[model samples]
Target: MEAVTKYSETELVLLLKQRQQSAFSYLYDNYSGALHAVILNIILDTELASDVLQDVFVKIWRQINSYDDTKGRLYTWMLNIARNASIDTIRSKNFQNNKQNRELTENVYESAGSTQLMTDKIGLRKLVHQLKEEHKVLIELSYFQGFTQDEISKMLNLPLGTVKTRLRTALIQLR
Candidate 1:
C-alpha cells in the first residue's frame, strides 16, 4: 500500500468507514502508541495492556460507522474505546485477585495514582493522586474500572444513593 499521508483526519475516518485496509494501517501506525500507553496506565501490566489494546483496535475497526463526527473527533473516540476496554478488563473477575493483592499491600485510596509501575503513566497517576480518598474510590470504581454505579454500590457495600452522590461529586471536583 502506498503511504496515506495526504488525507486529513476526517478523510481518514471516511476511509476507515469504507473499510480501507490502507487507512487502517495508517491509523494503527499513527495512533497505536498513544492508545497503548493509555491502556497500560489503566491495566498496569504490559501483557494485559497489549491484549486490551488489540481489542480496542478491533472495536474501532468494527464500529467505525457508528462514529458521529458531530459528537467528537476520531482520536477522542478511539481513546474512549481504549480507556473503557482497559477499565472493563480491570473490573473483570479474572483480575479480581490482582486487585485484591494490590489492595492488601497498598492503600490505593491515599494516593490512588501514587503507584506508577509504568513510566509513561506518570501524568495519569499524578492527576488521580490529587483527588480525595472518597473521590478517588468513586472515580476508580465507576469510571476507570467501568463499573456501573449499582455495581459500585454493591462492591463497596454502600447505599445506591451514596454511590451515585460520590460519583457525581467526584466528577464535579475533578472538573
Candidate 2:
C-alpha cells in the first residue's frame, strides 16, 4: 500500500466506501487516538476502553455505507460511534459488576479520581462540581454512567420528567 498521509478525508472516505483495507489502516493510524480518548472518557479504564475502541472500529467498517455526508462530517460520525459504544460499555452488566467490586475496595479520596480516570479524560468531572446536587447526579447517571431517563428515574426513585429536568439544568450549567 502507498503512503496514506497524502489522502484527504474525502478520498479516504471514498476508499472506505469501496471496502479498501488500506484506507481503514489509514483511518486507524490517523484517528484512533482521538477515538480512544473519547472511549476512555466514558469508560475510565484503559483496557476496557481499548476493547471498546476495537468494537467501535469494527462497527465503523461495517456501517460506513450507512453514514450520511448530508448530516455531518466523517469524523463526527465516527466520534458519535465511539461515544455511543463507550456509553454502551459502561451500561453493560459486566461493567456495573466490575465497577461495584472496585468501589468496595476503593478509598474515598481515590474513588472519585479512579472512577473519573481524571478530569483530563474529559473536563466534565471538574465542571460537574458546579452543578446542583440533583442536577449533578442526573448528569452522572445519564451521560457518564449511560443511564436512560427512565432508568435514571427508576434508579433515583424519581419521575422521568424530574430526571430530564435535572439533566437539562445540569447541562445548561455546564455550558
lDDT string for model 1 (1-175, tens) is: 3463767988999999899998898999889998987887677778988889999999999999999999998999999999888877866734565557456223434334454444334445556556787777787666556667887787777999998887787777766
Error of 2 at 7 (Å): 5.4
Candidate 2: count the clashes.
0
When summed lDDT is taken over every stretch of 10 residues in candidate 2, the lowest stretch is 101-110
Cα displacement (Å) at residue 49, model 2: 1.4
Model 2's TM-score against the true structure: 0.71
Score residue 35 of candidate 2 by CA lDDT: 90
- What TM-score does structure 1 among the candidates reach? 0.72
Where does the lowest 10-residue lDDT sum fall in candidate 1? Answer: 104-113
CA lDDT of every candidate: 0.76, 0.76
Off-target runs (Cα >4 Å) in candidate 1 are 1-6, 93-121, 157-162, 172-175
lDDT at 121, model 1: 40
lDDT of 1 at 48: 85
Tens-digit lDDT track of model 2 for 20-87: 99889999988898898767766777898999999999999999999988899999999889988987
- Candidate 2 clash pair list: none
